[model samples]
Structures are given as structure tokens and as C-alpha cells.
Target chain A: MTVSLRVLDDGAWVSVNDAREVSVSELWRLDDPSFCGCDLPDFVVENVLSVGVDGRTVTANVYGQCIGCGETGVPGWVPVGRLSDGKFVDIDRENTVLPVYDGDDR
Target chain B: MPTDVERWKSEVYGTEIREHLFRFAEEGWDAIPEDERDAWFERFKWWGLYHQRNGQESYFMLRIGTPNGRLEPGQLRVVGEVAKEYATGPGTNPIFGDAYADFTTRQSIQLHWIKLEDVPAIFEKLEAHGLSAQQACGDSWRNIVGNPMAGDDATEVIDAWPVIQELNETFKGNDDHSNLPRKWKVSVTGTPDGSGQGDINDLALEPAYKEIDGEEQVGFNVRVGGGLARNEPRLARDIDVWVAPEDAAAVAGGLSALFRDHGDRENRYNARIKFLVDEWGTEKLRETLQEDYVDFELETAGDDLRDQYTYNAGGEGRNDLLGVHEQKDGSNFVGLNVLVGRMGADDVIQLADLAEQYGSGAARLTQRQNVIVPDIPDGELDDFLAEDLLEHYSPEPSPFMRGSVACTGTEFCSLSIVETKNRQVRFARWLKENVDLPEGVEEFHIHLSGCTASCAQPQIADVSLRGMKTRKDGEPVEALDIGLGGGLGEEPQFARWVTQRVPVDEVPGAIENLLANFDDQRDGTETFREFVLRHDDDELADLVEPEETSYEDPMMHNTKRTWYPYAEDDELDASPAPSLADGTPITSDD
Candidate 1:
């Protein structure tokens, strides 16, 4: 099945299967060089996703090289949408938000 | 009296620690009592485990100590396999997946997303490879650092590898030093090239020679109390004592013991060895060490062979050992920049294979978050260069990328506000593409700290950026404050903050403008730090400030009248009055 992908909010959010599936603030490992080593992977979200729907869950077939490794045409997939409590919920990226700084300012 | 941390340790020693670990592994995080969690976390640090992602304490970060930054290919393969097996890829849960590792400035490996269940297996694997996470963190002596090019460099005053190993064997898992007032850092180096940064550790033993009974003796000159923290930044002071090679480890252990017993335990901030040294003075500390700790009489060193800051075309001052260099043994040691010290498991394994095949069977890590593969024969240097791993960890990197150092940013560190590793990488790439320097300017040391802790050593860079949050047009945004002219060596000075809060988006433009202006107006001999020091603070600030656009007055019909809203009357009078480039002045309507 073919699925549509849209980049929202300046590469912050990724809309997959007509739902905002990932937020840069939530999922991307911004501090880890592997994910955020270069400029935002604009190409990753900008490309279309050929997704497959299985019951209440949807899996998107994503193809792109990691911006960090710069390896292109690598096939990868991510969970785009899932059903929880009888409602479809977009799968948000995890561990992207940092702790608010409350330490000594030097 | 023991400090709170020390007291906690005394109560929770031996079987208690094992019990805590067993409980953590069997029951998982949710089963642990809320009030007892913080203490357990602190206890875990003694085993070289820390909560991953500063504030979010779900998974763990395990630090593996590499003595003097030396690792055999076999040991590295184990670390690589660990990263591939347990750390990398998707996690069991959202909070604990995609394991990766980073090389710390102290020359240790930090692995993230470590679950308690896997800790035992990881520990067994590490021990099998003669590696341990023990004492990687905590109040005990951390990793014993030495010159990464210790035996390889011909200019080295003395080989520090043996001494580093001696100290490591003496201290690792030793309960005598398992608890201290705070974390203790140590470095032992004899590189005459000044690549060894011994002046910034709690105890630094540098190469020194002295005349005794008319015969010159080679040994170490002790420097004590050097540390860098938020409120304290003190270069180590010379203790005026020369130690023989055999007695070096004893001197280090004695000093650590002294600090452990005498260091202030009430105020955590005032508990470093630096504070105690300041309170007792170097003279008293030396006297005590000689009188109380050692069996042999310590003599004062007359000659110092420590490295001094000198000009190097390929090196960043005397402390940097980046790029290719000839060894004393007629071999070549290639220092490759790891770009903020992040390397994948596959890359690590590949590097190990390369090191074993073409060069030595060992690799060394530098405090700069870079690595060195030494003992490459003169004939094999080309083949070593041709290795695919060099493409990612390049020996020949741009000056900015070569000198860029970053702390673990908000990604895994809790104390940081902005993400630093990727941001720093992007900034270096941007600088390389946008800015060009004048002749004689090759290296620009830019250090980025995720927060004020200065783990990246930002205070010692030519250009330092500290992360912070600032308001931009009434909305809060990530930002960094700029510091200039900071450096280390003979005349080390902490950088002065030039701009308080430049928006993260504008930092590149600001740095580019400043560098461009400097390139246009600098003397051929002046280094970037020297050029910055020559300028007035206000002038430097103006050089780096973002560009401002001006609008022409519609009524006057003259487009050349430059506005000086913030310029002082004296300043305007000192220079030519606000006028066009052609000296045309439009009359003010008022």
C-alpha cells in the first residue's frame, strides 16, 4: 500500500498516513552525533513513505541513509501510527527533549 | 568526619552494593524504593554506571576506563562487539534503545542505554578483555591519563606508559582510595612536544630532570590541585619536588590519600584537592607528603623539561598532537580527529582491524577526543592512510573541525540545555564552508560546552561557546555566549565572554563575520587569540555582532546618511560625523 509523508513545522514533525507520526523534539537523538551529526535530515522526512497497514497499526517503509553515516539508499522502517484504547495515535519520536537547566550558571 | 557521600559509602560497602545491584537487576527500576533510588544511583557510579540522559534516569551509561588511553585491538574488539550487541539499535522500550557509545575527554569509553539486566553480562565481557568500569567515575581516582603518544614520539622526555600502568594497577578497585571528597583526575606524561595536558588535573606528574650528586637524573615534577568546575578554575601549582620513576605511583597515591583524609567534606564545592591545596599551600602539602607518605627524601627539581607553547603549523599550540608525526623509532604515528569523539561500533572494529594490520596492535585516545594509531612503519604509512576508516576519522581535517571539542550535550547529559555534539559538528562544517582565514592562520580552537560545567574545556579554547537559553523577540530560544582569547600552555588564560547571548541560529554568522574581519585586518604573525587580545572588548563585540540594516529618510531624499543612534557624541566627533562614503553629509531636518 502506498502512504503519503509530509514534513511539518520546519522539519520538526513528520506526518505519515495522514497523521503526525514523529516530532523532532521527541524522537530524534539530537545530542547523539549519529542522528543529528549534520543538518536536519530534511531528505528523510521530505521523501514519500510507502507504508503498510496491518489492522490498527501502520508501518512505513522508509528509505534513506543516516545523515551521520552519509550512507544512502539504505532501507529502514519506523512505526508511524498505532492504535491504543480503541483510538489511533501517532507514534511520537522518543527521548528528544532535554532536561531544563537548573544548575549553576558559570 | 566523613562527608555525606563518604558516609553513604561507608554504610553501603561490600555486600550491600552487591545486594543493591542484584535487586536492581532482578526487580528492575520500578521496584526500587523512591527515597533509596538516589543513593543507589550514586552507589552505582562507583561501579562505573550512571543514569543515562541526565534528568531521565531510566537506563544507564557505563564508562570503561582505558589506562593512559591505551587499548589493545582485542580489547577494542570486545568493546565494539558490546556496542553492536547490547547498545546499538532499537531498545526494549522507548526509553532504552539504540545503544551507542562516545569517547570522553578523559580518554574513556561511555556507552549509553545500558539496562541493569545487561550490566552483569557487559561487566563479564569487559573483565574478560582485561577492562573494567570500576572507578571510572566517583570520588576515587578516575582513569589514569598519560600522553597518548607516550612511547611512540621521539621527543618524549620519558615513556609514561609504564608509570601509568603502575598507577592504574595500584589504584583500580583499591578500597583505600574508593572514596574521596570528590572526583580525582590524574595525568602522567613526559612528551616534550607539550601534547600532554597535565596542568588541568588534580595530580599531574610531568617530565623533569634534576642534578643530584653531580649526576643528572630523569624523573617527574609534581603539579597539584589543578581542576576545572563552575566556580573553580585553577591551574595546578608546582610542588617543587622531583620524584624518581619508581616512586611516582607512591607519590600519587600518597597525595590522593592525603586529599581523602584532609579535604573539606562539609561543602561539596570546596571539597576538591585544589581547595585543600589552596588552604594548606603547596609548601605545606609537599612537606607533609615528604615527611609522612614517602620513604625516600624528595629533592627539589632544578631543571624542568615540561613543554611550552610554541608555534606549530600542523599542531594546535604545543598541546595538540593531531595529524601525522614522525616517531623516535623511525615510524609514523597518525593522530586522527574523531569529531567530538563519537565513533560507531563498526567504525571501532574497523579501526582495530586497521591498527592491527598496518600499524601497531594498539590504539591510543587523547584528551581532545581524538585517537592515535602509532607504530606504522615508514613504508606502510600510505597503506594505513588508504584504510576506509580514515575517511570518517580523517587525519587531515580542517583546522576548525580538528580543534572543535564538545561535551555530551542535552542528548544524554542532564545538566545541559542545548544539544552540543551535532550542533558543534554542524557549526564546524558551516565554518569550513563559509569562512576563510588569512595566511599563517590554520587552527582555531572552538570549544562548545553544553552547560557551564565546561566538560568540553571551553575556557581554554581560542573561541569558546557556552550553551544557554535566551529571549529572542519575546520568545525563548537556545543560544550560546561567546568567549575569546582563552588558551593553555606557558601563559594560559581563561577566555573572556565577548557576547552574552547570541541566538543559536546567529552564532555561525557572528563567528564568520568576526573571523572575516580578523582575516582582513590581522598582522601575519598574530594568532587568532593574540589578534582578539589586541582588540578592545567593544571593538571585538562590534566585529562579531550581527549585521544591521538601515532605512533612508523619505523626506530628506538622501540615501547616504548613516544613523548613529547608539554612538556617543564624543565618539561621533572623534571620527568623521555620520556621513556617506563619499563624504556627503545630509543636513538634519531638526
Candidate 2:
């Protein structure tokens, strides 16, 4: 099974199999201390730089700002969603306290 | 390796895409393979059909590129008819209603809610009336923008209408120049008031004079690699190269070819020529063009007319083309303000009628998102002004109403974070009704762009508003990052983002308070831009006092999460999209 992953529309969206799965402007509760000093950065996803797969979990590198700390940068590889049977499954980014992974491993 | 877009373009792009497009339109929406939808959608932008954002599938925003924004004779009627007939959908905007035409900041017309099935018919109508969408949106020579009053402007240094027409004919569909790493925006300015806004285009040809063998020769001075997008703003750089009016197209082609060969293809974000210019500098770019691209010898920089620039300069002079102005032929051209740049379909048709009855049946769109009716003689000026349509699209509009510009936000664009057009409309109306401009300030520009794309040209306004998100009372609400003191003229300046993340509802109050401060602390008759220039960023940010006010913002919630921000249900699940030819929602079985 194959799932095509790409970021199109000038980083405004993350397209999974020609469908816009994740979009910018969504406020996410991110658990990434490296991105900012805050324990939990209430980050706004401004631009989706790239998307890739780390096993079945779909990860994305996004550019945005931590509203709490007023720090702006990419929050490494945040698991935006999961791929199940070659189909993208949505992550409730608004509710989910998404854990950030070290992006350098990619 | 090339990017997906580059590979897609290599496989099929330019004039070849039109055949597939026509076939798809004829065969219906389901004819397209599901896996190839993204590639096809991206390619469709070449023909000026942009696939609307998520939740709105099978519909497009159709752009008709009227060269230099010139709609000759009966062309405006055709656009209005296209909008009325094909530009409608399940969702209706409460403000703009069922069908409306958007006059873009790029001097083009955009009709939203266009079904793939209706594209052939719409293109047919537009073609019959001498208009085209080819190379309007995608990474090609986009719509050639210039002084809307090109031929008729009394203040013009040279009549650039012929030159503009020649360039349009040469590059629009030419196979060699049809593809590039990024979108190419060109401007040819002949007017001294700097109406063409050449400072912010990929390529600019501003009027200049050069001495050739002891005789004064009229031509254009070249500038390149200027654009505002993705938080990177740059004014076009003077390359110290001038070209005669006859050699303009040749030099343009050469520079474009230079961009095509050298511009970065791997990173779409860094593909704009502005980035290339950053790496190479103006000297290297000019050297490369001279060495490789062109056959003829390029002239050194000539004496330019930059000192005379006034349009959108943020001073006391004419910043916009609103109100009646004189033509070179001793006639009148009326510039009407189309607030937020969206006009309902019927009003569009009516305006076309008025243009025919009053002027030379020609209408031009300006970079300020306004319309100009040219060649109106003194005899018919009074009757044209008295028309009921002009009351709404007024030549003499309030300064707030006159200066309000916005981009298509979450309503249609994928790049947008918040609702823009209607919100700006509401903001303008509220400001017009409630607040007064500080004494002697006739023009106060407030531009609202939905995101970092900067489609509203927010950086060049008195008050710039870019979309963002902020928490209000433990709930996420739509917000704007407010900037101040940006404009174009003899000197161009991008707005300074002094205040960050202001809730949308409190924006009007902030503007009101900021203006009140300006009114109180001015040194005597200094313009708003001047006052802003004198103050530091900290002082300016402090001046922006955001508070709750009588002016309400309907789109406080996350508009990007909705199918249509203005729709009654306004939910992602409630969308009737990815529809069939008859607009019946397509059900998918997994």
C-alpha cells in the first residue's frame, strides 16, 4: 500500500493522496520545549514546510510561533497524523497535545 | 531533482494543459483520476482556474486576464455575464450575495465558485470578447500591469499603451517564455505619478530619458526582483540598465530567460526572482543578462523620473485615482472606489452599461482595486456622476472607504488564515460611519491581507493587517498582526509590524485610538506617515490601544476551519462539495 505525501499551495496545506489533510492557521497545543521556553506552547501553524513518514506516524515540519513565549521557529517533526493501511487518519490537532520529535534524524 | 510542480510542468504544462482541461470539462468532474487531482489542479492555474481551498472541491476561482486591466468596449459586460451565469454555488456570502466579480489588486478579474464543467463556456465567452486567462495565475508572465490610464493620462511621460500591448501579445502564450521557476509579475510604467507600482514587480520598466548622440531619447529604466510574499518583502533594485521603447520586449525576454535558467526549482519557497537577486546582487544580474541573454547592447542607466511619484506615496498628493481627473485629450476619466474590490454581478453589468453610456465604452482596473472609466467628455460627465450606481461605487468616497484594500481570505484562498474581503468591508463601513480622519489627512490606507502571501499589498498601507490567531477568554479567535507606516513613492517603505496579534473585534477601536493620538501629538500638519516615521516602534506599539468597541466582527472564530465562513451552517462537515456537474455532492465509498 502506498500513501503519497506532499506539501502544496505554497505551504498553506499538507496534501495526503491529493486531498488536503492538514492546513495552516490551526492553533495546536505542542509539547516541545526546544521550540520555546514554555512548558506547553500554544502554537499557530502558519506554514507547513514539509511532510514525511516516520514508520506509520506521519510527521511534518511546520513554521509558526509560540503564542506563550512569543518565540517563532519550526517545532521539529510534530506527528500531525498517522497512516493506517496507506490512508491518512486525521489527528485532532486542536485537542491533541502533539509530541515533537528530533527532526535531524530524517 | 526537480520538485513535483517542476516535474508536472515538464510532463504537461503551458498551452498543452488547455486540451486536457477542455476534455476534463467536457467529460465531467469524475473523469479525472483521483490520484492525479493535485497535479491537474496545480497545472490548471496556468489557464487562470485556481482550485478553491479545502472543503470546496470541484469548484474553481476563474481569473480573466485583461491586459493592463483594459476592458475595451463590450468586454466588461462579458465578464459580468460570466459571473452572473457561472460564478455561483451552494454557499452565499451575506455581504456580496450569490454572485460577484472580484477586481484583483493585480489588475485582473476573478469569479469564484466556478465549476469545472462551466470552464469551457466561460473561456469561450471571455475569448470572444478579446480576454484571456492564459498565463494569468501560474508560474509564467502573469498579467502585465501598468498605469490604468496609460494612453490617455495627461501626466504620462510617454504613452505606454502601444508598448504594453506589444509586450502582452509577445509573451502571453509564447512557448519559450511560457514556463519559469516562479511566477513572473511585470509592470510597464509611463506615468510620473507612479501608478504602475513598478517598485514591487519581478520586472519593472519605468519611464526615463537618455541622451543618444546629443539628442534626448525617451525610454525606460530597468528594475528587477521585487516582490512581497511569505514574510519576505523587497523593493525592485535598479540594475543601471536602460532600454529603448523599441527594445523593451527583447530585454524583458532576456531577463525572463535569465530567471528561468537560474531561479531555484527545488525550493518553491525560494523560487521568486527576488531571492536570486539577493544571492547574485544587481551587478552580477546585469552582467549575466548582458553576457548571455540578449543580442543587442543594453544601455547604461538613464535619468529617471522617480521624484514625481505620488500615487500611494503616503503624503498629501493623490494616492489613489478616485474622483474625476483630466485626460490628455482634454476629456475626463472617473475613478470609482470598489470597496474591498468585490462588486456584485448585477452591479458589474450596470457599471458596464454606465461606462458605455458615459465614456468610450472602456473600463480599466487599477492596482488600488478600483475602476476607471476613461474618455468621458465634459458634456456627459455630469450625467455619469449623477447615476445611482456611482452613489455606491462613488468617485468621491470617504477616505476610510477609499483606502480600504483586502485580499481573498478564508472565503476562497487556501493560503488565508482568516476571513478578509467582507471583514475589510465591515471595517471600512464602520470606520466611515464612526471615526473621522485626523484633520487634513485625506487618504489613510488600511490594507488587510489574510496571511503572509501579502495579496492585499498590506505592507504598502498606512495601517497593515496580516492574519494571525490569538486566544480571547480561553477561546481561540481570529486575530491580525497590525503594522503601520508603509507606502510607495519616490521612497518605498514596508510597514513595520509594531503591534502583534490583535483580536479582530478590537481592531477598529485600536485604529480610532491610534488616529486620536496622531491628532493630539502632531507637530502641525504632518501626514500620518510622517508622524509614524518620527516615532519609534515601541512608542508606535504603545499608541495602538486595542479595546472592545461598537463595531462587531462576525468572523471571530477560525474561518479556515469552515467550508464557507459566511455560510449559515459554516462547518467542515456541512460542506456540499466535490460535487458533480449538477452540483450534487459526490459520495465516496472506501
Candidate 3:
């Protein structure tokens, strides 16, 4: 099941997978480089029902219980990141010496 | 029989009425006839208003907004009349500002046990006397709080009343501002001694030095993204925008519009403008805001407004709502202590009378729950001292009153988890009587909030208390969650929750423990905030409770524990815990 990521200032990750598994730990090996987080399991992917982005920063959604937990930490978004998915991304804050941004900088 | 409005008003009953009506099969106002509608409505409204959480409900509270804690003579008299009418009973004489009114930290009047229906008439009457309750509550700007002693205090660099009035007019009920994606807050300061806590608002304007046209001029150093509620307690982050006074309102309006247009409405939790600012970096926000303001045709202040409004970086160039100080007018300044910002009618009248007797009937409310009576002549200082009100509420106050504040907790707020006013007063009085704080330790704040809503802003207090409930003998009882090391202004930081679930009864003792540590550890001229931050969680926790260092039982079990994502400790084996997710264990407080 797919899950959304909630990133902290220090690079830690928390994801509530579709199978209702709420995992918060250091990043494991990811298939893609840009994502910078761990890979979730297959059964956890089965439970993913829906997802949404929170103001372009964090991703959130509703999902069924994780195969791991007996209905614990199921309904909330655990923070994680997305890889390139065959696309390019830019780091906006790092662009200018002190970036003066305008609308749609996102 | 005709139907009565009381019979139709299902929302009138408190939680207690549900059980009583069910058990006795008793008829409520619902059974009253239509012809007796007005009489029934009056009786029912009175009964509802009279009903306090304790059931005696004898004291009905009416809160009057003193914009940034300012009040005129007539306003004071209005409050006095309300107190005289409500707080007094058959045998009980109202205690002036005690059972009467206690001037609040926020500069508002709150009278207790006022019948609900009479509230409309009371508001109308106050309006007749040149006051309105429109900015009091609900999806509105609320009161615009400025430095209480705006113009009179000699220490200030510039008077903030004009700017405060400007913003209040520009944004208060402006249709452009009425529709917000979430609630927004704004505060302005004329000097660096920030009586206005800068980090707890959506936008904060502070006095800072800047270069314009090759000369140093006073410009507002703007900060954004400060807020407190639930698990999201954060100080305002700095936005690289130094605005002149003339441009302050436009910036305010621009930010308001930005929040209205772009802030999150889908999830109420992520609704505040702070969340949006944090999510979109402050630099990006500033850029967008510039465009927004440009589109709105906001006039950027020319040098004329800049040089005219030079902010005075006065004595010590820091906050001072406590202690006797020299004002710009060359008169003595007296700081009146109002514990927890709960001002009543008699208290308002007394303060107004004192102000008139001593100065020009002008008083300023401090961010701390107290009032500053400035510009008193040397001769009148003696007369000011003779007033009997000074004993209970002193001008020569202690650190507790100078630093202590409590939000309207379970007493009135439907969102509150515990009672705040009585608890804060009890604790403040107890500490003053018992604890002998370090001499010259003029300010030390202790804020008690009813819940995580943080209306009292517990995060900035030297020793902060957030309300919680712990099960004692299988019943939930009120308690406090202790926080340490919050600072405001130039070096701003959010206080960390140090101790969890301290029973309300033990709050005084817990404070005693913390103060005892401060006495031993503090260097010369160190604030309580400095002392707490100097020590880690273990060290701070040890100071609060030396003998037993156990914090586990209270940490996980209590609702007051504000949870956040934590990185797992590598030392713990990655054994999959069954109930929770596989992977490492992480917690909010690292």
C-alpha cells in the first residue's frame, strides 16, 4: 500500500502504509535516489485506498489497517518522500544565496 | 397550549441536565406554554447562565475587551456596575476586583454569573458608552494588543498606539479579511524590550536597525509562522522583510489575503497561516507577499514616514512590565499586578480612578497579566501608595505576578480540559507567600493553559504548565504538564515539555522544586528560561523530582503528551513489535 511522508527538520521518516502499518525510522535502501527513504512491503501496498497532498509539503490520506498492527496507527499519514518516478525535481530553497521567492515557487 | 421558545431550544441544557431529566422523567422548559414564552425564556436563560461547572453556578462571568488592555473612565464604571449587579448576593459584599474584577494580562474586563439574555443589553449599554464587543470572538481579528503603556512610558522609543489603531482599522472586519483559510494573528512593537511576545503570532513586527538611502533608520524586523495549538507549538520564523510603519498595514493585509487564498481548509488541523508559511519557506512567502501587496497597490513608505517614526531603543532595550522605571515624561511608573489577566468591574473602576488621581487617567496593559500606571508625579506617588487596593494587587510586585498568566480554561472555554483562573491565582498567591525568589530577579513567567490550545502561550514561560487529566483511583482528575526553557524576541525558542502529568494539588510543590533549582544553578542576572535550557531533560527532570527519576508511567499514559515523529535509536534491535509498526522506535521528544 502507498503512504505519504511527514518530514522533520532532521532527516527522519514516518509513513502510515495502506495495511495500516505506521512506520517511523531511518531510511532503508530506496529503489530511487531522489526519494531518499526506505522501501515499503508488498502486502502493505494492498491496503492503500486513497491519498492527498497537504499544501505541497506533506502527503496525507485514509487507508485500511496495516497487515502488521491490529488496527493501530492506521488512519494517519506517516511522513515519507517520493523518488523521481521518471521525472525531475528542483530544490527551491537552495537556489539563490538567499532566495526571494514569488508565487508558484512550489 | 402555545409553544415556548424555551421548549424549542434544545441546546440550552448543560451536561448535568441530561442525566437529571432522564432519571426523574422531569419536564424541562420544554413543557412550558407558548403564552409564557418570554417569562420561560428569562427563567431558563438565567438558570443556564447561573449554572457553573460546580453546579452552584452562582457567579456569571461577562468579559469586556480592553483593546490591548486600554480602558477609559466610563468603561471602568461600566465594568464596576456589572460587578456590583452580579458578583454581590444577599449577604455577600463584592470584593473590589476580587469577587469584583481582576484586571487581566490581556487588558480585558471579565465579570462573573451574568444572566445570558441580559448580555445583549449589557453589550448595548457598553456600546452606548463608546465600547463594542464586535472584535471579542469567533473568526474575527479579536482584540489588537499593543504595549499597554503605549504613549506614557518614557522607556519606549516610539508610541505604538497609532500603528495599532491603523492595523485594527485596516483589518478589523474588512470583508477582505473576514474569510480566512484559518485564524491569523498580528502584533507590533516599538522597542526591542518586547512586551509583545513576538513568536506566538502569524505576523510580528519588532523594532530593528536597517540601512535605507545610506543612513541607519528604524525598520520593523518582521517574523512569521509563530503559533500554538495541539502538537504544533512553534515560534515565529524570521521573514526577510524589514517594513516601515506606513507599509506595515499593507503587509498585514497582504499576508491576510495570502492566508485567505492559499491556506489549507480541507483539514482543520493544518489551517493556520503559520502552517502554510512553514510549509512554503519564509523566503518564498516573502516574495509572494511582495507580489500580493504590489497587486493591491500598497504604498511603500517614503523616507518621510521612516525618519519621523524612529523607534527608541530605551533602557536595557528589553522587556520591562515589572519594577519601577523612568518614563519618557520624567515621572514615576508603577506596575499594577493583575494575576492571570482576569479583570472585573470594580477593578476596572479602581484602576481608572487611580489613573485619574495620579496621572491623566491613562493606564497601559502589559503582555504579562498586569497594568502599568505611568507619568505619576513624585508628590502623587505617596498618595498612590495610600490606596488600599495596592495591598492585594501590588505595584511593587514579585516575579510570580509579573510572569504568571492563565487562559480562560474549563471555566468558560468549551475546548478547555481543566480549570485555569482559580488554579493560577491559587498557585501565584501560594508562591508569593512561600518562595523567596532571587533579589533583582524582576521577571519570571509561569503560564498555565487549560489545554494544548495554548491561549495562555505556555511555550514562552520560564516555567509553563499545560492542563492535563490523570486517572486517580479510577477517576480522571485535573493535572499539569510542565515545560521549561521558552524564550521570546531576538533569541526565540519553544519550551520543551519536561514533566508530564503533575497533579493539580502538587503544582505548588513542583514549582517550589523548580525554583529551588534556579536558586542554586542561576548565575548573576540569569533568567529562569536560561537556567532551564542550560540543563538537559534528565537534568531538568531531576531538578523537579530528585529522589525518584521515574517519568515513564506518565509519559505514555497521559493525553497531555504531545507526540511527534522521532528517529529510532540504533541500539534497539529491529525486532518487529506486534501492535505498532515494524522498524525502529521513535518518539516526539528526542
**Which candidate has the top score in DockQ?**
2
Which tens-of-lDDT digit does each residue in B33-110 have in candidate 2? 989998999999999999999889999998888878888999988988999999999899988899899999989999
Residue-pair clashes, model 1: 6
- For lDDT, the strongest prediction is 2
**Between the candidate structures 2 and 3, which one is better when assessed by lDDT?**
2
Q: Which stretches of candidate 3 lie over 4 Å from their true place?
A: A1-106, B1-63, B86-105, B295-319, B438-442, B473-475, B521-526, B546-590
User: What are the per-residue Cα lDDT tens digits for candidate 2 across A19-43?
Assistant: 9999999999988776788888999
Better of 1 and 3 by TM-score: 1
lDDT of 2: 0.92
Please give me the DockQ of candidate 2 compared with the native complex. Answer: 0.81
Fraction of native Cα contacts reproduced by each candidate: 0.00, 0.65, 0.00
Clashes of each: 6, 0, 41
What's the lDDT for candidate 3? 0.54
Q: List the residue pairs that clash in candidate 2.
A: none
Candidate 1: stretches off by over 4 Å: A1-106, B1-4, B13-19, B89-98, B307-319, B546-590
Give the Å shift of residue B514 in candidate 2.
0.4
| Model no. 3, DockQ | 0.02
TM-score of each: 0.76, 0.99, 0.66
lDDT against the true structure, per candidate, is 0.67, 0.92, 0.54
lDDT tens string, model 3, B303-374? 212222211111133344655666777788787777777665566678778888887776666666677677
Rank order (by lDDT, best first): 2, 1, 3
